[model samples]
Target: MKTSLKSAKRLFVALIFVALGSCSIAHSGDGHSLKVTASAYNSVKSQAHGNPSIGAWGDHLKPGMKVIAVSRDLIKMGLKHNTRVKIDGLPGTYLVKDKMGKRWSRKIDIYMGTDVKAARRWGKRTVIIRW
Candidate 1:
């Protein structure tokens, strides 16, 4: 009977672990995956720097865009550029993190914009940028 009880406890713990794993993987997706390459943020930086060729860049941000609000606090929490994360939308931020975040600059901001309501969705994130 003790062995059976132990097995049940182990099974319960395993089930909880699996549930939490699935929940993490099921991060918020504004009805789309919005696979944006790192180049997008790079473009923003260059454009902000008066890059003439920036005009030919992709369309500006729209609503429904998943906003990855990578802020100074995110850095404090260990977030870095090019770091991928699964986070829920808080109407102005995302819980992003990275491994090499401790050794990075603190003047860069990253945002994502999809063809959908990218701006609105992005607005829900902390990475605020004009479209």
Candidate 2:
């Protein structure tokens, strides 16, 4: 009876470990979730330069990609360059392509290709982001 009880305990412990390991594996490739404030920007020549300097990825911003500039602090929190993120209210996912300046914290800048008016309209708002 004592040997059987020990065996049952061991089996229970092993099952718990398997469950937790599976949960972590399921969430691994899918980036973690975070809530953040977001704004928009455009590359129009009139308002500001149309081109961004070399990003953390060591390349210029691609025109058509759904990309966002994340705050420096967020980068420290694992939202690093090339990380894919999903905006809660938005329809599609975005990539972390650039890093914001030190003055900004907990903010994300959505890149709207050459659409100055759209960027201005987007403005700023609190939104849920999954990275």
Best by lDDT: 2
Candidate with top TM-score is 2
TM-score attained by model 2: 0.68
lDDT tens digits, residues 86-118, model 1? 432324433232111233322222344332233
TM-score of the candidate numbered 1? Answer: 0.27
How far is 122's C-alpha from truth in model 1 (Å)? 4.9
Q: Go through the candidates in order and give each one's C-alpha lDDT.
A: 0.36, 0.77
Alpha-carbon RMSD of each model = 12.0, 8.1
